[model samples]
Target chain A: MNITAKAHEDLILVTVGEDRIDAACAIQFKERMRELTQAPSSRVILDLSTVAFLDSSGLGAVVAVMKLLGPDRKLELSGLTPTVAKVFHLTRMDTVFTIHPSLPDGLQKAG
Target chain B: MELVFDSNLDAVRGGLADLLDSGPLCAMEADARGTAEIVLAEVFNNVVEHAYATRQGRIKVCLKNHPDGVLVTVIDSGSPFPQQQLPQGLLPEINAWDDLPEGGFGWYLIRSQVRHLSYQREGKHNRLTFCLPY
Candidate 1:
């Protein structure tokens, strides 16, 4: 559940620094997300480039985070590894959120 | 290849690591290996969360490589399925964002990734078998 949050001008770019998010750490992941996303930001972009694996529990945790953001705010995702992307695709959750191939140009250099 | 571990979420992670890092699973292509991990994790955790709920037990996993794919059998000394049968594994309905599903995707994922899913209860154990195509 290692995640770092950087505040851009209008959004918070949160990068997950873990290789796997599964049943073992799904709850902690959600709780940490709640704490990191407390600051007001219209949009939050989650970078999952480093995450090589995510199971159903991990996927649910991501959905829970999006719901926590509520209607006013948005939770976008970027850098979905093949396995993580497959989970979203199979569950049809891919259509539920806005997915980016990678971070926008400005934030790319921040990492 | 066979692996036995305590029925806990953390142990499930460690067991998967061990299973994937050695044996035939270790030699799989990257994409196939990723799918194997995802499908196996869901299956193992379900037994920990549902079958062994509020109790402690051991889970045994056996993997055999075939010409087409790898066959997996997971045995647990815990509760059987509600009606001694598997779930329909239909996709959960996607509703409003606020009401989106946070769970119920486990069976769907397992069902989608594996083939020839079979569940049987013999004596005091529950046996679930599935095949992962390479």
Candidate 2:
């Protein structure tokens, strides 16, 4: 559950440095996300490029983070690997959140 | 391919990595292999969470090549399913933002990817079988 967050303008870009988010660390992931997202940012984009695998528990953790963000804030995603993308697609969570193919152009260099 | 490990999340993680890295699993098409890993993880972790909920136990996973796909059998010396039945695994209805689901996707993911799923309580052991199609 290694994640780094940097505020770029109005949004906070959080990158997951771990390769897998499964049952083993789902709770840690959620806790870490809560810590990283403490700052008031309208948008929080999670960079999952490094996360190759995410199980159902991990998906649940992600959803919980979104709920924790509440109505005014948003939790978006970017760079979902194949396996990770499959989980989102199968669960229909892909429709719930706004997804980006990669980091935004201006933020790519910062990430 | 067959392997047995103690019932725990870390062991489930390590065992899944080993299983996906060896033998027929590694040689599978990327999509098929990914599907296999996803299905197996959901199934195995379900056993770790539910079957062995209150006590310690062991889980055994057996894999074999089938004409249509790969056959998987998981056996665990843990509690039997309540009423000796498998869950229907209906996708949780997505309603408002307040009602968003935080869990219950495990069996849905497994059922979506695998076929010929069957379960049996053999004395004290729970035996579950499914096929991952390539």
Candidate 3:
């Protein structure tokens, strides 16, 4: 789970640098996410543009990150590939997270 | 094709990826390969977490490819599911993030992606068979 985090204003944009997030990387993803998100701003935008595939474990990891962010902070998602978006839609997780079509869309809105 | 591996997270991921090779049934259509990949990942992880639990064992996976669809069979010798059956229907009623669900979406995603899914326990082995169209 090679994830990169950068802060922009009151938002922190985290990008996942992996083609797939499954059971193999779910733990690592969550652990790294917790570290990256320790110092939170008003919002955190998770960019999944590079993630071509996501499983339930991956979905859970995202949820965990969201909870770790607590209620005061917000977690948004962007750049979901078709396959990755399908997981969110099928699980109805799309309703839980504010999703954007692209990183720029989320970034602009967050700003 | 058959794959037998330790009931571990890493192995589960590798096993699901192995099923998505560039074969005929593994063709790319409506993101079917991606569907199978996600479905297999969820189902395989369930076996490792629930069936195998903390016990060390091997999960036997078989992939049967057909012109119309593909059948995936997963066999594990650990404890059978609590219900000894697949959850009826899929998706849970999740409309808000107020009480966001942290889990319980694995089976729903699996069922929604596949053409058919089934689970059964024969003696000491739990057999789960699911099929998806390409």
Candidate 3 residue pairs in backbone clash: none
* Per-residue accuracy of model 3 over B1-134 as CA lDDT, tens digit each: 78888899878766666666644445667587777777777888888888888798999988777555887788999998777877764566764455667678887777777775778889999998878777
Collision pairs in model 2: none
Question: In candidate 1, what are the lDDT values of residues A12-87, reduced to their tens digit?
Answer: 9999999988888999999999999999999999999999999999999999999999999999999999999999
Candidate 2 residue lDDT tens string, B1-134: 99999899999998998989997788799999999999999998999999999998999999899987988999999999999998888888787887899999999999888999999999999999999997
Clashing pairs for predicted structure model 1, backbone only: none
DockQ, 0 to 1 scale, candidate 2:
0.90
Instruction: Give per-residue CA lDDT, model 3, range A1-111, as digits (tens).
Output: 589888897889998888988777888999998899877599999989889988877888898888888888989998899989988888778888899898764364442
Better of 1 and 3 by lDDT: 1
User: iRMSD per model?
Assistant: 0.8, 0.6, 1.6
Which candidate would rank higher by DockQ, 2 or 3? 2
Top model number, DockQ:
2
TM-score of chain A by itself in each prediction = 0.97, 0.97, 0.92
- TM value for model 2: 0.98
Measured by TM-score, how close is model 3 to the native structure?
A: 0.88
Q: After superposition, how far is residue B91 of candidate 3 from its true place, in Å?
A: 2.3
